[model samples]
Target: MPRLLWPLLGLLLLAGCASNKERPELTEVDQYREASESLESRNYLTAIDQLKELEARFPYGDFAEQAALDLIYAQYRAVDYPATVVAAQRFMRNYPAHPRMDYALYMRGLANFNMEKGLFDNMVSSDKSSKDMGAAKDAFRDFERLVNRFPDSEYAPDARSRMVHIRNQLARQELHVARYYARRGAIIASINRAQYVVKHYQQTPAVPEALAIMAKGYQRLKQPELAEKSRDVLALNWPDSKFLDNDKQVDLAWWPDEDDGLLSLLTFDLL
Candidate 1:
């Protein structure tokens, strides 16, 4: 063969092998099976690719819907929660009444739940400013939608539990903000944050702290009526609270101004 022709033939052979490697013809079921095996073997990224290929090749195949579903799960297994949420939502839009619709919705909520869960860790830390409640709020809405739409779905119970957790976390976050403001003598801001917890997260466990913060804030603001009202509500709800231990002591009903001396300021919180 001529030297030039030999080189051209080698190029053609490489192209042929590359094409075969790029798109080896596989049946939809075979492709899905490979994806499933990849998922089971913990090769989530590979599973996602294979599942996507299957879906593309067999848009109307018997395994197409399942491939799509599996892709969502694979994305989640890969710790790609954002992509998992997107995939899950797309599945729901494409198959609103699929037998696994509940599963997709649950995953959507799960993703947001994970995002919000980080706020809990940040909240417990000293840097209160690092707290981020946006994800928690989004998760709450997602779980709420799941509960409302699929009350009987197997995932409903878990979703409800997550929602409750998120609610309590949010209430605590509000209380945290209230405390931060209170420490800075921002009494009005402190009271507002505490009231938010009472109004929005009434079912949460943080209500007592909210009420207590409000009472203290009202007292510092020198609004005796509102402070007494807050204390009354707190007593009604939490009669055994430490804040009310000195309630009967009229002298201790309010703290003296900081200028009164270090002793007055020191005992202000206890009073």
Candidate 2:
């Protein structure tokens, strides 16, 4: 061979060797099987990587939908809640009429449900009611949508039960704000918030406190008739309520403390 041709031949042989050593691309089924093995082994992070690669490689393949579902679960198992939520939402949007739509909804709600309890938050023992309820509200809406759309879905019963708990939490959240306002002497704001808990969150434990707030607020505003009405309702429905005094009137303790304390100043005595 000519001198220039010899060098070119050597380069060609090296390229051939490299090509021979290259691994073959995985088939859709192979990728999915690998991902499933990772999941079964509880190697969720590995499964997440494999499932995502499977999705990217076979976006429109036969196993695409299943890969998407598996990715959602893998991310969830890995504690990647935000990613799980996004993957679940994508699945729902892509497969709106899929038979397992309810499952997707349930997972999305569950992801958001646990999103509030990140690692650091879980370490501390804090009151759930006192924490920000944004994620909880989002979770409630998702569960509600699931139950409404798939009343007979296998997940419906659990969704319904979660909704009841969420409702109670939301009621307490509102009452907490109402109490804060009451302590600040923002009587009208307190009354409005309390009424919201009563009207929208009926049957919740917060109702008795809400009634007590309303009755006291009315009395402070010099609306004797409205105060009497609110007091009567509290007496009738929650006779054993802690807010009721021996005389069956709204307990004086239910109202804000008269002393202008540091907490009142810090909270600005306003809602």
Candidate 3:
């Protein structure tokens, strides 16, 4: 508490700070070992910084390629999807023939796949089919490429499964658009959208719904022949489809009615 002693204490604190800040320069191997330790401890942000520094300082060092791969995984584990995708892409571009090429592709696809997810996605059903499909489509293509290019890769099986899920999502998206148009009295547009799902999505679960929409749409347009054809096809292909009421009429009660104005918007139709 003395005035002279206070100055000395301040000088000692500053010297300690300076000593902490002045770390010895680390060798490439040492830097990589530090990053690996961070990664092992699940300190992804710290690992990301360390890995990036390692890559910058020794781009072609023995650990450079592994560092790049770890960067992708670190960014992903940090929930930084966009950065994960970028790092994965850079790894693929830089090391096309690397033994872990499939890993890079898988991470890229996985990043894009989860890019549309919200913070509460695990708690609430956000209806992924209602979200923008750009990232989903990108993820689909990435997974497809992984499957085609590395069928034997350990990641290929999961990639194939995700591809199937993405395909169904795409089909559901077309059905969603069709339902929107139908609710707005856009019969032709709804029919066109539904037909596109049937034609392009084939065996997807949405096919039955699409056929039902098309049937109802044609009936609304006074095209009885087309309506009958759609109904017949639905009966023949999906005998147990809920869209077929006792295999006679189209049952679309599951589809929402026309917009209910402010009430629908406020309640999101849950009411």
Q: Quick one: best lDDT, which candidate?
A: 3
Q: Measured by TM-score, how close is model 1 to the native structure? A: 0.79
Candidate 2 residue pairs in backbone clash: none
lDDT of 2 by residue, 41-70 (tens): 999999989988988888999999998898
Q: Least accurate stretch of 10 residues (summed lDDT) in model 1?
A: 248-257
What local distance difference test score does each model get? 0.77, 0.88, 0.89
Candidate 2 positional error at 130, Å? 2.8
Let me know the TM-score candidate 2 reaches against the reference structure. 0.87
Of 1 and 2, the candidate ahead on TM-score is 2
Which sections of candidate 3 miss by over 4 Å? 1-21, 254-271
Candidate 3 residue-wise lDDT at 211: 95
Off by over 4 Å in 2: 1-20, 120-125, 252-254, 257-271
**Candidate 3: C-alpha lDDT:** 0.89
lDDT of 1 by residue, 78-167 (tens): 878889888988998999889888888888887776653443665575332237877667778888888898899888899999888878
**TM-score of each predicted structure versus truth:** 0.79, 0.87, 0.87
